[model samples]
Target chain A: MTTRTTPCAGSEAAETEVILDLDDISLSFGGVQALESISFDIRRHEIRAIIGPNGAGKSSMLNVINGFYHPQKGTITYEGVVVKAMKPYHAATRGIARTFQNIALFKGMSTLDNIMTGRVNHMHAGLLAQALYIGKNRREEIRNREFVETIIDFLEIQAIRNTPVGRLPYGLQKRVELGRALAAEPKLLLLDEPMAGMNLEEKQDMSRFMLDINEQYGTTIALIEHDMAVVMELSSRIVVLDYGRKLADGKPDEIRHNKDVIEAYLGVAN
Target chain B: MFYREAGDFKTTYKADQAIFPIALDRWFVVTVVLVFLVVVPLLASNYMLESILTPVLILSIAAIGLNILTGYAGQLSLGTGGFMATGAYMAYKISTAFPGLNIVFVLIAAGLCAALVGIAFGVPSLRIKGFYLAVTTLAAQFFLLWLFTRVPWFVNNSISGVPTAPPRKVFGFLVSSADSDPIDRYLFVFIITVVLALVAKNLARSRIGRMWMAIRDMDIAAEIIGIRPLTSKLTAFAISSFYCGIAGALWSFAYINTVEPTAFDINRSFEILFMVIIGGLGSILGSFLGAAFIFLFPILLNVMPGWFGLEISVTLVTQVELMVFGGMMIFFLIVEPHGLARLWSIGKEKLRLWPFPH
Candidate 1:
């Protein structure tokens, strides 16, 4: 059934559902054609997975959506506002956050401190506030600490809160990276290969976390993963990119049965 | 274990952010400061006071400045002595030209001039980093030093090209080079150095200091975090050169008395850098430690003759002092890679728990 209905009076749709529309985005990196006419639409509260093999431009596609790499052609409209060529920080400040393929936590700082740093843009306290550290500044600092503590509790990293991020295990590091991203309180969370190098148990835990983030917080998640089974289980809609092109876009079952997807995954099923 | 913060509590933020939060560490610093100010002056001979304490303190201020730019901001520089020369020569030209002007005013004017020079050199930091930046600063050092020597106006057409710091009264008391009593000069340098050190310490904990440290740690991350690197680095250079200029003014007015174009030599720049390295990168206390070590060595070298009951020429002793200084620098680099500041921190870490250490 079509979910579309007549526009209701005295109600704002933006206040309810968010739209992430990437329209005919074409991008090239030097001699390599990284993405060609790639288009995808992500709705609020839905889990969207972009699954593909290595060198399939999956990461590049995500980077484009988040404004890390400005596309040579095309437009990305988030919440009805078209995003032009802008730096990564611009996206960060505008309620969009992402975690890297390799965990990019500030290694020298504590896990709690690393997460707290993610709130740098959001924090109203400036340099003067930092220096004098007066009434409101102290209050803000306490507030920041409290906010970080909640994330630490959510991730169950209370025991290692004071520990440096560099010394933590890889799975824990990935969790910390996720914590940092979540610290930004982004409306759209982009996870690039979140389960890239995780063990089965870790991957399951991450999937649960992702689901919790979606169901509990109502955050829209766009992920890139190699695990087909996990992708089928988690995503309502799957985006398959092959050689800088969208090979398949449909429901989990539809993608699973698609002959083109089968050919792309198993090389003609030989 | 003894060296744990298991029970020692910091109820206040100020306490937590102290230069040394531990009670024992605090006392140790107090004790050291007391020894330097009160005990040393009484015990040490006039010649020792004149020759060592004053010079080391002056150099310590300069090192702290360089540490701000190079150590904290990650903008490597080799033109420290040139900036120092800028201060010294400018002070000389001004003080000699306008004998009626307060010595303090001349020193400040000289510092301002050196700050301008520092900013000029700092412009290159925007274009380069690491070794390339260091080489560019080295060019500044060579050029500035050359200017002082080649330009006749700098020395006021004096045959010797080294201006003499005339007998000058500060608040009705004559503090002058004509006295030749190094004690009075040492006292003047001591008061100024302490004031400068306190100011530097305050500045370090300021907004600019955090910005510099952020840039130093990771520049790209810093930019994204909203810190402008150019603004932070240039400010660091200006403040650092200002200190170097002051030190240079003190070098001529208090210690050297009559300076030459070669007075603010390249070796002096290396000496200041070594002070930071041996003391600790990004540590004010380290600069003082470094200066004290360098300052004490030459005097100890002078005293070796009386202790050993041997006759070594003063020139040979000075040469040997340089060799020993060079050797000690290498030894410190190998022994404590993080410098004396790290050693101090480690010692404090152990002492934090004291008798209960595992």
Candidate 2:
């Protein structure tokens, strides 16, 4: 496991308390290490980016934080409580929501239905209430519908509201995916390759939405992305990973000129 | 222009999310219900009620049950027949055990019993999925069938291995018994189907339905999005079985009027599946359409040969019917895999855009 002693120099500048604290995180699939001794803190209401080339374990780190993968050695402290053996659904209930690298909207369902699913945790109506859809459940549904509609309107997806996500184009699907994640009203939102395979216009749109979400909702974001320009422009702090290890942890300006990061991006000699 | 929603406006989310959102659609449903309740019993012949309309109503209820699981929830279940049998036998036993219980309560109790059994079988689904989960549910079908057939206790130790539905009363009207009026039985089952169907439409439009669709769409994503697959999947199975159980209770008491293990066989499972598929996998209307197609199509074939002044052998007619049914299923599947419901929706869409290019 690679260990780095980077002082908490940036946290003092941001004035935001840590929302997620990963301590001595190490994960390996068989003998191949995915992440090694990585430690970082995502602060409250900050857009944080984990950027690296292929096989740098960016996606792996997001998976660990979301409780999709349990590291061999690590402690994830979420909201000041050390989440012990936390399940994915439990993480979701704790308000940790994420969008996938591949758009994962329910293909057979309308965009409205897909986004409404994000409110599943917020919804408390039981089976009989839902089955009957009367009084309490109906009111709950309409309330949630209003909430989801806000997301839809915010995302400007009214035209495709009734269309199946499967029938949507890739860019619109990505937008809808964000809408779904946003509908959760998550405290911490993770975006895995949110701008992957997008044209220039779509990427700009997504970057704008990401910025607006962070500013408007005060959502703490931890996004894994390959787009360096978007990462540099959008995120307040950047964590750079290389060969399953954290190379640098600082602001975007510090990351851009760090000697180690430069060498990591431009392959180091043996 | 007739189907346009130009003048009608939804003032609130509740009005917008109504089962029939448009005024015309709402009126259409009201008209259909009125015709079914008032006109069908008065105009239809006894033979049509007994051989065609009655079975369509009952089986559509069962198909709706299966559609909730296979279509909406994306859980492929082959244990539908077993669940129905559970309802049938439980209703029979309960009705006999308590002689004075209302028939309505007995049916509800039967559905609850089947729900318990459904939850038990659905436990394996948390681990298994897709066709493998389907195979596991198949075990439920066979196991429950074996239990019902072998256990004479379910049949009340009857010599015939058949558990007959005891006579019962609904709204002070004698139905679910031999010599009961066909129209009375039809009305009872029809009311139940209509009510349940409306309930299903409502459920499908609610948060619970969205969770099922999420799980069906992508379970891993669903879990990440906070849907507990265990609860969602099991709830789907339980509710689906409950609907099937009621349909079974109604089938035995109202339609079939005789209970045998063979009645809820694997063929019945396939038939229900066919109904959901042909009717439209995730649609209430599709369930009725598919059931009508399956039941009434055969009757049509039986009468068509005579209408054409051709005398065909009964066996040959049956053969042709099977071939024609298989061919039609393939045709529908190939033409529009979404089933008759999609076709109906497409027509509605066209109507909405009629007299205009776009």
Candidate 3:
């Protein structure tokens, strides 16, 4: 129901300048390699989807981008600056916000509080002012609350604004997680399986919100999704990973027709 | 009927974010404060003022301190007594060194000393958590108590290793020492407790409070959300110790009127922890409730047997009090893990939905 032009109309524009570039990245845990020689680039203001089967390093790629995990090898470049290492909070302060593959909302906190936490970077009230809660702290809190309320309205989660995220249904939890990330007003939003456990109707609603977020805010999104149909419809470009290696990188139509991608990821018996 | 809020509406965010949202709750608090200021001293006996009321008010401040660290920030600490001792000694030194300084400033300076010590011990919390972090705080408690005992500088090399607190005046009114009325000391501690509690309540509802809660609820998620665990956790330590330090200063200067290394021992730390656990971890009111219950229970236990004309031995009464205290701790842990604060909230929740029963 969100008023927006088709998502693809702007995907073909020549103004697509690269915002993130990962070159020859590798990661391993103990002796097992999680990713090897993976390379990809995400352009500005586009919905980029990463797809793979289970344990194919899709989540790890998202982790590396946000500085949750350090790759043993490879360099990550964002907006022409090379990041030698990533600390999670550092990346968040730099306007890169992300949702986890699992719903990682603070279960003990209410939805409003959870979303309010996303404004931590922007809030600068010191300890003494906060302890008094008289002027700056109070004003900052109200202002952030207003901003978070907009996110709650955007995601259509007004009814459950006070509910503890732990009690919400899986689909609603995912939506709240998205709201939390969007509260950061990020330049690049990373979503790990945003619709992983959603029903068809829930998936449709989530897809619409994602499109609205991208259209209204002009936010650059990179999401990992397993649903081929949802990926094909929502993403401007798709990158396929199989067994810790990149199998294909192209538009959804090209990735759909690529034999190696279909065989490695979709398990097509060709 | 009186608790109903059907017609009440907040016209602004400032009103909505008030410490007490309900009009009735606000009125109730106003009434309590008025009564404490105007009526309490007139009716309370010297024994009640000295033994029960002063200790409750002071320890409640300490419990609030622990709640900020262990409750709000989810950092378990057992160093409350150590920090309290730091405050007591620092206050003693500051008062003796500069006789002209106000006792209030002395207490504040002592609290700062305790905060620095708390931060020093809290550094280990960054690398460890849960039971291990607790052990580190326990180490701080033992180490501080040992330091006060072994080092004569803290006690000013007194021959007895115990010093009677010298008389102190605040605003030209005698508030501490044998000559001061119990009511004077009670009022003095009462005002300080009230002020510090208000500050704690404000802090618990502010952005800093939310950040601590985020770290407590989930540290990894909190980090990704742009909260620095190092800073938030350490601040929780610092603030918690600051409160405990003030409580410690009051313990020696206003309540006990004496300074001794054994005054703040490991037992004191455990006692404060019990108050936090039994009161409610995260609730400011819970800290006061827990302190009152812990402080008054033994006296109640002692008086109950006598009231029934049973003529029970003092030893038997003490044993029964221990049994009852342990039993209540376990019961609270099992039945209401959130402590008495959760129960209070549940009662309020019922009042909010009284006419339309769920």
> Judged by DockQ, which candidate is best?
3
B6-58 per-residue lDDT for model 1 (tens digits)? 66687764565554667666776689777877787778898688777778888
| TM-score of each predicted structure versus truth | 0.80, 0.96, 0.97
What ordering of candidates by TM-score runs from best to worst?
A: 3, 2, 1
DockQ of each: 0.20, 0.76, 0.78
Candidate 2: misplaced stretches above 4 Å?
Answer: A1-13, A268-270, B355-358
Q: Docking quality tier of candidate 3?
A: medium
Per-residue lDDT of B64 in model 3? 96
lDDT of 3 at A242: 83
| Candidate 2 per-residue lDDT over residues B161-196, each given as its tens digit | 875677798887877877788888889889989989
Tens-place lDDT digits, model 1, residues A34-102: 999988888777788898878999889878877668899888998899989866667777777888787
Over the full model, what C-alpha lDDT does candidate 3 score relative to the true structure? 0.89
Q: Going through the candidates in order, what is the number of backbone clashes in each?
A: 4, 1, 0
Q: Rank the candidates by DockQ, best first.
A: 3, 2, 1
Fnat of each prediction, in sequence:
0.07, 0.94, 0.72
Question: Highest lDDT among the candidates is held by which one?
Answer: 3
lDDT of 3 by residue, A138-185 (tens): 899888888898899889999998798889999999998999899999
